[model samples]
Target: MQQADIHAAAQTLLSRRLNNRMTGPLKAECRPNSVSDGLAIQHRLLELMTQQGNPVGGWKCALPIAVDGLTDVPVVAPIFSDSIYTTSPCPIIADEGWCKIEPEIAFCFAQDLPHRPTPYTEQEIVAALSGAHLALEFILSRYLQPDSVSFIEHLADCLFNQGLFIGPEISLEQAFQASTIELTLTTASTPEVQHFAGKHPCAEPLLPLFWLVNFLRQQGIDIKAGQQVITSSYAGVIEIAPGDYFTLSYEDLGEISLAFTQD
Candidate 1:
């Protein structure tokens, strides 16, 4: 199919979300032929989605988990303002009653790295960061069958992001202190108190931030002030099941709790 046809199809697919979307339609529809085309479609999808009033609040990035055993570029996508929440006593459905909780560190920018003639360096980008916070990302799949989808399909779908839950802000310096942080995940409903001696997979959390600055520049997108960017997952995807209540402690840094209910 042509690029326009592909874009329109992708938009429709994204708009419909999981409703009326079947797994069998994967091989036969809306596949972009190249990365550029796919990314273009993704931009349009974001535009269309945001036009509905859910403005872009921030972004979430994750290193692609080698689709089908083949290496793929990292995926970055806008996080809508409506879905982002400061963790509280509020209720969250987690979209379809299930959500993948990825404990991560998110950087909030204090200065805008606007579209510039010269690229923003790692040092400049670092200086612009306002603070860091402990976050739990909620994964939302655009396709009915995520595994049956292709690489570009995954890309255009924004790497299965639904939303993010960020806790109280902390100093950037304080965030760095937990470089080799120990994490404990405990749920009252289960006997499991899983402990992880976690370290940023990239050695330092800011490494991804540095990469993201350049990546956005390459894509001709500006990094806005006050916009938060979550680096990547420290503890892969942890699904929240019914009656599940979790307390994730990050060594000496801090901790956050999540309570999940079927209601």
Candidate 2:
């Protein structure tokens, strides 16, 4: 796609976000037709957001998937500074009276990893982390029918990331060793508890960080200090209602007690 088209698409998406609204696919002339186009739109979207004073605070990514002789590189999106919360009840824009969230672990960076030609080793990557935390990734898509849209379109819209709730701290070692977590969810609305044998989609949570740092480096981007990076979710999306208090227990690592309120 042309640069003008990319900027136009990003502006369209940003307007929807600023207005707290959703729309169908972009206009044909500016729609993303490839991964590169989607990434260009994302880059422009970040620039537009920063211009509006919402700087990038962190990032969210997943492992890469291959299909039809093409690799859909690990999807990535910036987590705006204004959207990250440390306390609850975290206000959210619920869809159809329901709030959606994903349980994941986040690692905060202690130092900057500047762009370089040399690939960063796993040891180097682990050494840079300051701490780990149990986190909930809030979801609210900018598209009307998210499933009906193409992957590129979703990628351009930051993968439905509305915000992030950074919960209590956990041991970095424990988080790294947590290949499987016995998760339990209790809510005020129901007496029954929801149990899930949560498994990291990539087996190791830090693996995606390793891939992400190198990927960004190759793209001439730096991993700045104080930025948190969340890998794959332990459990898929879970829906809860507003005015409901919920507690999520992640095995023995830690638990997060929070309540959801209407945005």
Candidate 3:
């Protein structure tokens, strides 16, 4: 794709979302000849982030995990912006539509990880993490082609990452000694409001991170120390309609809730 194409695609998907258009086929447009293709796409976005008039914040990586009722393994495509907010409920309009809201936990890094390096052990990975928190990440995307299949395609199309509402921080070790926790997601809503609950996927959430560290290493990309990683969650995707209150909670961790109108 061309630079203008990248920018235009980013803007359209950012404003409208990936599901807005019904593109015909789910074909792989971005050739994943090398892992750098994906990383390069990420870097391109990182560069674009400077337009926000601030330094690039931390990293947020999303992985897909199983949920009880949701059969389609919806990719947990999330975005990260650093220190944008702290310990409070922030609001965002996802897809300019009323039915979609997201809440998640995020990790902030005090140190930077290698841009590229060899296989990393769990010890090396744990040492790099700085803190954790319950955050609200609004995910938006539009289908360039029918199937939103390519992870790289999503990367190219802005990773369905549009905005984030962040909160307080906690040490990674404190949450789970082994750097992972299992998550459970639940939601409740009255005619007036709705909320989604999330927790570690297993007894440990860090397992996904550990798995991701290896995945990245195998792909030749190094997860820097200061980057943020969001392990997968079991909360099935919740749809938000207009004029409703929404809350996403991570039991014992934190809660990210918000309210919005259809207009």
Candidate 4:
């Protein structure tokens, strides 16, 4: 398909908050020759973003395969100007014509992701962490359609990544070494707090750093110097509605509270 065809298709679907249909021939129409080609289109879209003057500020990472509790996918998205927020008690827009709050784990990088190969050693990832935060990622999907959507599609669209509220920063050393930590997510309506509930597979929650870095490297996109990388949520991506309050605690890591509103 022509770039305009794809662009128009994306615009129509996004405008209606719909998912693209990937049917027999339609699938062939939307399909890029290869994953790298798909990424090229995404980059071109980012380049055209300059004409709009709101450059992508950074990036947010997601575990597309992590949904079923034990899977992994290599995809990340640009953190647009409108999506970056100061981590504090804040508001988030939601679907269902409203807004809701969500608490997440976020990481910041100290240096650029080196141009290299996959299976980046744990040491390389550890050395890159500049900061960590108890964050709130506003999880909004384009729509609730599965056939037309896939993990890779979300990655290309910044993973439907709308906005993020970040909290105070701390050294990765502190976040990584902490063991038996508790994470709580709460809202005004619920007495319960969402918890991390399990130990991070590695010593650090920043493990996804290496995974994402390697993913990008394979795609030929350099994680330039001074760019921050927000790792995927180890917990699940829960749905939210408007009028919700949320909080997350990481014991020594820190605590974050957020309120929500609708667009």
Cα lDDT listed for each candidate: 0.72, 0.89, 0.50, 0.58
| Regions of model 3 farther than 4 Å from truth | 1-39, 51-55, 62-84, 87-91, 144-151, 168-174, 177-203, 211-226, 241-246, 257-263
- The clash number for model 3 is 30
lDDT of 2 by residue, 61-113 (tens): 98777633558655788899899999887789987668999999999999999
TM-score, candidate number 2: 0.97
lDDT of 4 by residue, 1-263 (tens): 57865564344333332222222211445544444445554565565554457566566764445532325544677665555778443545555555533445566767777666555677876676667766656666554563465555554455666677777776666656653456666777878765666344344556556666777677666665545566655454555446666556767677766655544
Instruction: Quote each prediction's TM-score.
Output: 0.86, 0.97, 0.61, 0.71
Candidate 1 C-alpha lDDT tens digits along 1-263: 57666667666756555242434333454676566656776777777766777667788875544654546666777787776878554344454556467888889999988765677787899899889998877776766667777777767767677678887677898776645778898887788788877777766778778777777887888888878888778777776665577788887778988775332
Ranking by TM-score: 2, 1, 4, 3
Question: Considering lDDT, which of the candidate structures 2 and 3 is the better prediction for this target?
Answer: 2
Candidate with better lDDT, 1 vs 3: 1
Better of 3 and 4 by lDDT: 4
The prediction achieving the highest lDDT against the true structure is 2
Residue-by-residue lDDT tens digits, candidate 3, 97-196 = 5445445566665665554556667787677777777665555455544243455555555455545556556557655542332333333455443333
- State in Å the error of residue 220, model 3: 7.5
Each prediction's RMSD over C-alphas, in Å, is 2.9, 1.3, 6.5, 5.1
Candidate 4 has a TM-score of 0.71
